[model samples]
Structure formats: structure tokens, C-alpha cells
Target: MESTMTGNASGKKKEIHVGLCGAGIGGVFAAIAIARAGAKVTVLEAADHLGEIGAGIQMTPNVARLLRKYGVDKVIGDNLVRFEELNLRRKDGTPVGYTQTSRIEGALDQPWWLVHRHHLHQGLVTVARQHGCNLMIGSRVVEIDYLESNEVTVRTEAGETHVFDLLIGSDGINSVVRRTLFPAVKPRPPTTNCAYRAIVPYEQIRHDPIASTLIQKLTMEVWMSEKAYIISYPISAGTDFNMVLSHHRPHPVSTVEDISMADLRAEYATFDPRIQRIVDMIPNAQRWPLLVTGPLPSWSSPRGNVVLMGDAAHSMTNHMAQGAATSMEDGAFLSVVLREVLAARIALPDAIRLYERERMPKAFRKQQVSFLNGAIWQLPEGEAQRARDRAMEPELRGEPLLRSPNLYGDPATVLEVYGYDAEAHAERALQEWYNGQDWRKDEGTGIEAPVAEKVMNWFLPEKEKFVSKI
Candidate 1:
């Protein structure tokens, strides 16, 4: 365990020690980024094994671009299925609209991909290990203490205490770190939305004539209707088909239970014949309650030494498929700020503040948009639904679906969400902080000075400044 202090005997800059709570996609990715930025990182995972339980995850270009930047793209790309287009259909498999992802690929300079969650998780674990990040599995973080010396002390359930310069709460929605920091903030109850997921072997589906053609083209398909929607894509290098069916419930289910194939079929009885056939092929499915968190007043602790990332900060609905992508973006941004802090270009507190400042707004917006997008997808039949279908009819005529007026208010079309550059945003923030443009001013006197200067001066020697008193 290396300390985050400088002034070593070798005359080299001391490594910034970072402790991350949770070793899911967000934590592992953050560890890799910070380790590559020349910081020493340790990830604490409560699970005995480092793996993902989900069937598949959609990787948009925004996330792919950062993975490429970290050189982990190849690892994920090797096992992923690249789709050329996204198809929106009705319950009966009638084409409503389509989006050529090729356009997105060309504009973002990266391809969109679908991958098995386990494969992606394993790939990230390998990359983080290669970058020298220490992974502590089965070590649940039960408590966190901010020491008076400006260090964060993490205590695990295994009775181990580790001190670090900063602590990142990348734990998922039920984060203990977040609860310890903000005890009064309770996550909103699960909405009426519930998702059922299952993976069927391509071989099983390929034997059927109707399903065989679906696997051949490598396309992401969505069946939208009133009160329910189904999204299916090929994963595991097209060997398996991942499916998720989100439906509205009149009342919330108390627990996630194994849903038998017969019950699943009964639920989708009104769906298209193709969907019924696919559901029949699945042996079993798991029901997952779609839980969302209300916006928190802040993502960082009062001291700014501890902060939340990923779902711990903003757990959005999976409507836009930005849940994992946004978390990876958080990792990318934090890496840049940590690198600057390690190089002495900025203070650690300022780096963390900048991270929160840059990420909080975008994260909250994604949360809101995810909810809204899901609502639009599950719109009931009426004049509004008819208008939406009419708007989508242009795409069937070879026109761009995004050009439809109906999609103007949709967050999926927002360039900031889809075309964000995490690295560039981080670099710009650091540059501004370095140029003294990000300084805070006294309300009454209007005296200006970098917030980093004020925080650093409390720990280090004071330096001469333009304005002596604020």
C-alpha cells in the first residue's frame, strides 16, 4: 500500500493512493484509469468473484472512444457484436422506424457494440490488473472515516483499514459508502417498471426459420407498444441472443423471482408471434425491478475528499442504454483529473471538485432523460401514439428517423449525451483551473483566488498571491 505523499528519496513524484468502493464496471474502470495516470489504486468488492450478472450491455461510441483511449477497446471489441442499424418495431414485428448506426459510427469515429456483461467485466478486470491496480474481492466496505489529516480511511467488513488520499464511491445503487455519507437520502421506491431478462443460445433460435434470419443480420431490435417494450440483440460474438422485456406493473413486486417460461409467455401473450416464439425458447427468466434514485443535493462529501461515481451518484433507468456508458465516462474524466493532480498541476480537492462540477449536471440530466425516454417508449395507444407512429413513418421511407419532429424533445437525440468527450472536458477544466479562471470570489469584497489555493494553503505553505485578503 503506497501513500499519496510526495518528496520521496528517489526524487520522483509520489503516487496518489486511491481507494475505490465496489469493483463493478465503474470501480474497475476507474481503478484502471487512475492506475494508468500514475496513481496507486485499490478496488474493494463485496462479491467473492469479480463478474457481472447481467446478460448484455450496449456500448455507445462515447464509451468506446474512451475505452480505445485506454487501449482496452480491443479486449472488448474482440468478443462483441457490431450492429449496423437499430430497428424500432411494433409488437407484431412491424417496422416502425430505423436508425443507421453507420452514421453514428462515422460521426463519432467509433463503432457501436453489444457484449455479454461477463465478458466485458472480465476484460476490464484484466486491463486493470495489467495496469497494477490491487483488487480486493469479498472485502465489503462497511465504514469510511475522514481523518483530520485530509486522508480517507476505509474500513472493510473483513476488519482491514486502508488509508488513501481520496476515496471514490463507485458502488452501485445500494452503496454503503453513500449511505454512510448521506444517511438521510433514501433511494426512491421502485417504479412500476420491471424488467425480465434472459439469454437464449443462437443455435436454439437458428433452428427456427423465423428466428434464424434475425441472428444473421446482426441488428439491434426493439419492439415497442403500450405499457411494455422488448429489446433484443446478439451478443457473445453472435452466439447468444440477449433479450430484455420491460413491462409496467400495477403494483411493485416485493422480490425478484424466477419466472417460468409459461408465465413469461402468458405475460407477453399479446406480443407479436416472433416475440412469443423467442419467449418460448427461453427456459427461464429473472425479473429485475427497475429502481431509480432521486437527484441528490451533492455528489461529493462536505470535505470534497470523498465522492460518488456511477450509480452511486446517478442511477438512471436503462431507457437510453447509457447506464454503463455514463459510468465509464466518469472513469475517463476522473483519470484526467487524477493525472493532473499527480503532476502537481492541480490540488487533489480541486481535482475532485472539478470532477463533481463537470459530471453532476450531465449525470442528473441523463437520469431525467432515461425516465422520459422510457415513458415515450411505453406510450399507450391514442392520438399521441398515432402521431408518434406517423412521425416514425418517414424512417420507413428511407428518411432519417431522428429528423422527425416527434424526437426533438427526446434525450436520445441530444448530442451532449451521445457525443460527449470525457477526456476533452477534463482537460479543459484542468486548463481553466491552471489559468486561475476557475477561482472563487468573496461575496462581499469580490476578492478572487483559486479554490485550490485556499484548500492547499491549509495543508501546505502559503504562497504569494495577487490579492492578500479576501
Candidate 2:
């Protein structure tokens, strides 16, 4: 597939093709969306073999709703475990605040789900295949060419040249597309915050009394101490449990050269006795420094055809668990805007800008909020701990954190974010591009697409197979 770069100054969609970089979750879904909108999409993944590695991912209702609309709900539904609450507590496991996941669920008009990342990626890959999205794995993008006509030509490490109407830089934080677009800015190094993620089988935990209790609750629990926080949740719900320990480290670099179960136990030695019991049950762990980036000046290329998505565009700490959700939202919105722009015969450059215009502000806001959440979650040691204790002491005794002026100074601030409907916004954006509709009306009216089941059941059998094997 090849095409000579040309300016669509006349605003026509007859010649737009998209080259999507990265075949991870973001790139896969983006391909599905663009293909569903009747556009030709080519996905280039770097890894020789493409697969997901993470244990558990929290998919908010907003994200679920988008998956439902984009014809990938079957896989998501089959792979997800619905989580109903967000429980916050002190290091000793004393309750500080508990909020019903329903508040977020009802707002997004879908269920909040915890799913294994591999299954989610497989589901997206399946959908893309069904939609005629050409996927080439092991094709690492080494360079990008953004022409004056707002077209992109990507060259792979194998010396293969792929040209398309638009190039999407979904390759991730260390994106080659991003580097080529903005060479001056080096990616920020990993910060002091480090995390150890481990998944333990539920059967092993059933033998241990304390571990069994933590697993039986079906609750995503967090034990917070001045030094660190331990969070674990049932992923396959009774089959396996995933654990994440977040802590502040001194300037000395902590490497995971010999990351054994013993090392994991030692790290959590200071955790509450109950948390320690669960940590002891864990047989394996992977440690990595959590790297985050502040907001960027622009997410689009200087000429406008190439753009970034997900971690590539805005990599932030996982304090809010909105990383995957935001990326899914990006995939959903980009597909719609690109399709509408083509259908209405809008200029390619303007279409790209419109996308950047709509997504950048929302993404930047989430990035900022996520950063703040991380800072608050991992406050400085001495006086900060005391101040947190004073603020939480009343709440622990029975007052709600929402009302204590501690957690959230005003709960209303949440309405701005938890309440966003990305699909509704995409539709309004489509209407504006196709029929001259108002953009402001789409802003926060809570108008969302009602959930629908996809016709294809491609993922049902795979889910059954994975579950049965497990």
C-alpha cells in the first residue's frame, strides 16, 4: 500500500488513509474505530510477538460504554469483573472513606470493570481483524515523515516504507513518532515512586487464613502507611488476585535484579500485619519505577496530520486508574472525528486540529488531576503524615471523607471529570463537522450512547477457553 503525499486543501476525504503506530491496546482499538468508520487503517507494532503483560486494569463505565458502542463489548463483558466500591483506609486497615462505584457507574451509564489486559488486547485485535484493519506485527517504526500536505510516511527498522493520509503516534511515551516530532524534549526519567506488581493464585491463598479473607471480599483494598500503600484486588474473581505496592524511595536506586518472592515479602515487611499476610502469600513479583510526564504544550505535529494517543500523548501516574479508560476514549473519539471529517469533506489538517483541540484540554486536565492524586496519596513523610492523620482521625471514627474537607476539598470537583461522556462529545463533534452543530451543547450534558451488544461473539469462546484453563 503506497500513496504520494498531496494537500487536501480543497477539503476532500476521497484520499485519506491512516498509518497507526503501535499494536498495543490503544493502537488496536484505534484501528477498529477508524475501520468501523469505513477508513483504511494500517497498524504497525514493534514487538516480534504482540501480547499484553499486565495483570489487572480498571475500566470505568465511560470506557465500557465506548467499547460497547464500537462493537467490542462482548469481549470486554466476558473478560471483566464488575467492581462495586472504592474503599480507602489507613495503614492499619481502619476505614477512612468508602464510595460506591455506582456513583461513577451511574454517571457513565455502564459498569466499572476490572479486566486482564491481555484479554482486552486480544479482544481489540480480534475486532480490528474483523473490520479489515491491516495489522503488521514486528514492524518497528524507526522514523516518521510529516509532509507539508499534512500526510505522514513512516519507515520501519527493516527499511519498509509505509505512507498514509494520517499517522497516529500511539507507540507510547518513548514514541519514535513523538521523538521525530519534538526532538528537543527528552522523556523525563522515572521518579522516586516505585511499584511492585504481583499476581497470586486464589487457590494458594485459600490455604492461608488471612489471605483467604482478603481474597473472599471481592473488594479492591488499599492499606496506606506513611511509607507506602498496598492494593490488591481479585482479578478473575476467586481464581487469581493482583497486588500493587506503591512506595516512596530514597535517592538510592532500587533495582529488581533478583526479584524473588522473598524480596517481595521483605519489601512489605513494614505493611500492616494483615497486608503482610497477603504479601507473604505472593510467590512472584515484578518491580518497575513508575514514570510520569507533566502536560505537553501540544499533542499534534507542527503540520497537523500526525498525533499521539494514550501514554504516548499523556503518560501520568496511575493514581486515578484512568489511563486505559482515557486511551479507550481517545480511540473512540479519534475514529468518529476522522470519519466525520471525511464524510463532510473537511480538510485533513483541520480534522486533525479539531481532534487535538477537543482531546488536548481534556487529556491535560486528567494528567494534572492524576498528578495531584498521586501527590496526595503519597504525601511527604513527617509533618505531612501528621497532618493527614489529623484530617483522617475524625473520618476514621465515622465521618465520611467526602464531608471532612480532607480528601476532596469539595466533592463537586469530581463532577467535572467523573461526569464526562466521551462518546456523546464525539457525536456532537461529528454533527458539527457534518451538519454545523454546536460544540458547547455537547459539553457535559451527560448525553451518552446507550450500551449495545456487538453482533460478533469472537471473544466469547476465547474467554471460555482462558477461564476453563485457569
Candidate 3:
């Protein structure tokens, strides 16, 4: 590993050495940002190789903003599928509501993206490597000795030990790092649902009449019913169609385990024929038990040098699809904090405290709303479900409102959730600490065309980027 990870290296003694456990979205995002901010970061990933298992994930405007600014968006390029529309339907395949995504994207000055989880992970890792961040694959943290030394000593499962000025646990929900940091705090109860994510290659079904026609829609079509919802969309640059089948379970499963195709078919036997056909084509899927965690007393060590990010700190359901984005936000916010501390603009303790204080409330909102979103989708088949369907009328006509039944159609909620900028928030936090001038007065006031929008407009004059309104 290089001695420095920045455009400018002093070629002298290092200022700070940061260690990160897990190279998932949050850890890698932090690695890139922190390295770019002028620090050395060593990533220890437990996996034998670097990759993502899940097939599909969505990135709202808030995450898109960070990626675009850091050039990760460009790196992913055409693999990114900009959602043009989202359709809500009943279990019988009856249309309930429809909303255009461009309106929200335009309002936020960022694009809504759907892509293979591997693509997103690869982009982040590429950028992190480019920034000179050292990646130690197959190194899983087994022990931490922060109590005895000024620096943290992390021994991996393989018995190799490494030292760092700061240790960040960006590992997922079952984080060993988080356990060491907060010994006795119990994890939140698991959600009463499990999600089976599967991808069907379009090439395999291009000859089938029903499947081929539906696969080319390029929109997220969600089918809702009592206690379950199925979300499907194109991923892997439209070569694969991704499906997320979430259903209510009386008791949560113990862990992510292999799911049988016949068992999955039985679970969704009551669904529409189209859904059944897709499930039949799925070669494999893992049943993932959704979990909610944290709002713990804190996410840092007593010494404030060892910290938790991503699922290590907070894990929520996928109802809102903000799980991964929130993880990335942790790293993005920390980048700003570390930048100030490295430049001597803020004290390390105060900066860390600012991160803990400011991020807690924001994270709380996400955790709660994620549960709320699940409730709305999992409404029982009754008058209440009908009433919810009626509330989606405005969005069905393409006019999203402040409080639409379709949460994504509600502009206010979209802005509140997707318009968040962690880096900007970190900036604001520092200004408040010093009672400095406001730098965000002009931000969020105007919409500038993103690079994709500009090129898309020029290349495909016939293809309108946004339809109707902003």
C-alpha cells in the first residue's frame, strides 16, 4: 500500500491511517471519499473475492448526487438504467397507479438509477483503488485491541494484525466489529418478511411471447396484495430482468439461506400468471430475512477512534429501498468530517461528535419511514386496501402530490428522502459549529441538467428525457 492516498503527498510521515472492515457499498464509498480527502485507507474484506451477491438494487437521487460528483456514475455508464416510470398494480395484474420518475429526478437535479448490485460495487471499488486505498481481501477482523494502545490493532481471522489511527466497521448487519464496539446492546427485532431477489436473463426468454413483451417495458412494475408485494425491473443494462419478491412471514428466518424454486412457486401460487412464469425461470435465489437494527445509544467507541458505518450501525427493511443509500451516506458524511479534521479546521473529537449527532436524527427518519412504507404496501385485502388504492388516483394520472398514497409519487417525501446530501449536511454542521456564513442559500434552489440528460437530449432527440412536468 502507498504511504498516501491523495493528489498531493507530503512524502513525509503520514497524518492518519484509517482502517475499514468490509468493502461493501458503505466501506468502499468511505474509502474513496476519505482517500480523496487526503488520508490513507486500508480495506479488509472478508470475502475470498470482491463481489456482490444480490442481483439488483435501486439508487435514489440522494445517492445519485454523491456518485455523480465523484464520477462513479460515469464509470457505471450505460449499465445504469434511469427509471422513466413506476407502475403499481394489484395481485391480479390490475393497474392501480402510475407515476413518472423524471419529475422527481428533475426536481432533485439527479437521476434515479436501477442497476445490478455488482455494477455499483465494482464502480465504487474501482474508484477506491484509483485513489490508492489498500484492499486486503480474505482478511476478516476477528479481534480489536483498542483498549491497550493509542492506535487500534485489528487481528484478522487469518491471524494477520494491522494497526490504524481509526477503525471503521462498514460490515453488514452481522458485523463482528459492531459487536466489539457495543457489547451488550441487543439488535432490533427482525421484520416479519423475507425478500427473495432473482434475475432472469432476457436472452433466455426473448423467444417467449408473454415474457419478451413484458421484459422490454423498462419500468419498475410493482404488484401489491395482502401481506406481499413483487417488484420487477430491468437490470444489467437491460440484459437481465430483476425481480424482488417480498412476502409476509409469521416468523422470521434465522439467516439468509438457499430457497428452492418449487418452494418459491408455492409461496406465490396465488399471484398472477405472469409472476408465476417469471418465478419458474429463476435458476436460484437466497431467502433474506429483513432486519432492523440500531438507534443504539451510540455508534462509536468510548475513545471515539473506532466507529460503525452502514449496516453495522443501522439496518432497516428494504420497503423503502434506502438501506444501501443510507450506508453510503455514512461514508460520504465522514469524508467531509475527516477532511476538516485533516486540514485542522475542526477538532477530531468535535467532528466525530458532529457526525454522531447530526446523522442520528436523519437515520432515525429513514428507519421509521421504512417501516411505514412496508405497512402501506402490506395492507390487507379489504376496504382499507381499496381506500389506499383510491389515494393513488392523482399519481395514476401522472400528477404527483405532496402526500400521495404512492410514497414515491409524493414530491415532499421524495425530496425529504431522496434529496438528502450528506456531504452538504456535513458542511452545514461545521458552519453551525463556528456560526459561519451560510453556503447553501443558493443550493436546492435551481435545477441544472445532469451530464446524462445533456448527452441524451442531443443523441436521441426523439426520446424525451422527462415527460409532462418537473
lDDT (Cα, 0-100) at 376 in candidate 1: 72
Index of the highest-TM-score prediction? 3
Error of 3 at 59 (Å): 1.6
Ranking by TM-score: 3, 1, 2
Each prediction's whole-model lDDT (CA): 0.78, 0.69, 0.80
- Write candidate 3's Cα lDDT for 1-470 as tens digits: 11122322443333788999999988899999999888889999999999887889998889998899899998998898886788888888778888788877877778999989999999988988889999889998899988776589999999999999889999988898888988775555466677888989888878676666666667888888888888998888888889999886677765887867788878877777777677788888888878888788888887668888888888888888898999999999998888876776665556667789889888888998887887788799999889989988767666646687787777667867997778867876765565443331223443223323333432344446331111
TM-score of each: 0.87, 0.83, 0.88
Candidate 2 clash pair list: none
Q: For model 1, how does the per-residue alpha-carbon lDDT over 1-470 read when each residue is reduced to its tens digit?
A: 12232323444564678999999998899899889899999999999988998799987777887777777777766677787777887777888777777867765567788899898888899999999999999899888888466889988889999998889999988888889888887665357888898899988987888767676778888888888998998899888889999887778754576766677778778777766788788887788877666588788776668888898878877888888888888988999988877776566777777888888888888887778777777888888677777888877777654455223222346355666778867876665565456544555665554443334322343444433431
Q: What is candidate 2's TM-score against the reference?
A: 0.83
- Error (Å) of candidate 1 at residue 343 is 1.3
Q: Which stretches of candidate 3 lie above 4 Å from their native place?
A: 1-14, 186-189, 436-470
Decide which is better by TM-score, 1 or 2.
1
